[model samples]
Target: MRIEPAFLFDLDGTLVDSVYQHVLAWKTALDAESIELSVWRIHRKIGMSGGLFTNQLLRETEVEIDPERIERLRRAHAEAYQRYASGIRPLPGARKLLAWFTEAAIPWAIATGGRMETAAVNLAALDVELTKIPVITRDHVRYAKPDPDLFLAAAERLDAPIEGAVVIGDSI
Candidate 1:
């Protein structure tokens, strides 16, 4: 017997055209915190967990890090991202592909490193109904990408084994 593979997707840059928005949002947050960092540098950390991204950036910039500042940055990014949400849209083929999967009765889920506060914007662009779809966000898991928690949880949501799933994303 062969098992049908399940598809696990990333929401931000994969399904929605929100990667640059995320970079700019981070830039906004960093600027608000008086942290001077290049936009390209922030882009490099887009798909990573926010905590990891913040810690790495602070270490690289030799800046003092504190929980209070991290919270502030998170809030600022969420607010800034909301400002750019109006510009977000589904990728050219993202909606079509999802439709095809639905028509074909394929099991799929979205697993994003973003927490719900920011992910809601991208998900809205994709027209994803969270109640009908399995969406594993950073808010639902202890760790994010590179830790496999998001993908693992997504696979579980689909009742599919991790070995029988494929991850689709636009980042590392």
Candidate 2:
């Protein structure tokens, strides 16, 4: 028997217009550590996990390594990102696309690197019904995007098989 297809959508920049917000948030986090780096540099590493993002940024900037600062930086980014929560809104066609899926009875879930607090804001802004489906956040998985763990977890939560599942997002 052929299994039904399902979709996994990324939260930031996919369903919601938060790419630039993420860039600014990361910059703010780095700045909180008194680490001065170009926003352009941080922008390139947008979708990485908090830990990986900090490590990669430090490596690329050739800055002194400080393992203790990763948590501080993450907390700073979380705080900085929360400021933009009220400004967040669904992207054009996001509602339509999700509605189409709903109407067609297709199962879809959110797979994101964003934390639950921020994800909750975006979902509320989009009016997405998490009760009906599942969301796989960075907290749910060890690795971030480009890693299949999030995808796998989302599928499992939605009871969708991996073979025919698809991920829809703004980034690669």
Candidate 3:
């Protein structure tokens, strides 16, 4: 018998409406460093790892950030994100879509660019059952989207083939 296709869902923009919330959080964090970035620019780096995201923004804007500042910025972002995470919610039909996949016996998991702390908050906000769900977050992989590492990890966790797996996310 042929194996079924395993689905990898992105937690931020795709399933939940936390994209802008993330922007605000990052902005707040960067503000602490006195680094100002346009929301559009921040949004563009949302799907990348924290270090890569910071480096990209700095490169694009021609700014300078030391290693200590980078570490501080990461911590600040996580704290700020949690502070503003209460307002997060699921996207239209996100719950229904998850339910449909569950009821249909589809294999799925969350592969997100979010940190584990924020992932837990978003998952609780959405009330999505994750007892058996495998979630691969930024902490789990060396790279983020467009790299296929996250999806590949999820597929491995699901014991499914990667060739036929479909990734679902709202980011460009």
Off by over 4 Å in 1: none
Sort the candidates on TM-score, descending order.
Answer: 1, 2, 3
lDDT of 3 by residue, 1-172 (tens): 6768999998988899888888998899888888888888898778676778887787786777689878888899889999988789998899889888889989999998777877888888767667778889888998877688888999999999998798898766
Worst 10 residues of 2 by lDDT: 63-72
lDDT tens digits, residue span 49-158, model 1: 88888889999999998999888998898999999989999999998899889889999999999999999888877888888889998999998878999999999999
Q: Pick by TM-score: which candidate is best? A: 1
What clash count goes with each model? Answer: 0, 0, 0
Ranking by lDDT: 1, 3, 2
TM-score per model over all chains: 0.97, 0.93, 0.92
Among the numbered candidates, top lDDT falls to: 1
In the range 1-172, model 2's lDDT, one tens digit per residue, is: 8988999999888899887887888888888888899989988888776777888889877878786777788888888988967678889989898989889989999998877866788888778887886888988998887778888999999888999799887777
Better of 1 and 2 by TM-score: 1
TM-score of 3: 0.92
CA error at residue 97 for candidate 3, angstroms? 0.9
Model 2 RMSD to the real structure? Answer: 1.4
User: What lDDT score is found at residue 37 in candidate 3?
Assistant: 84
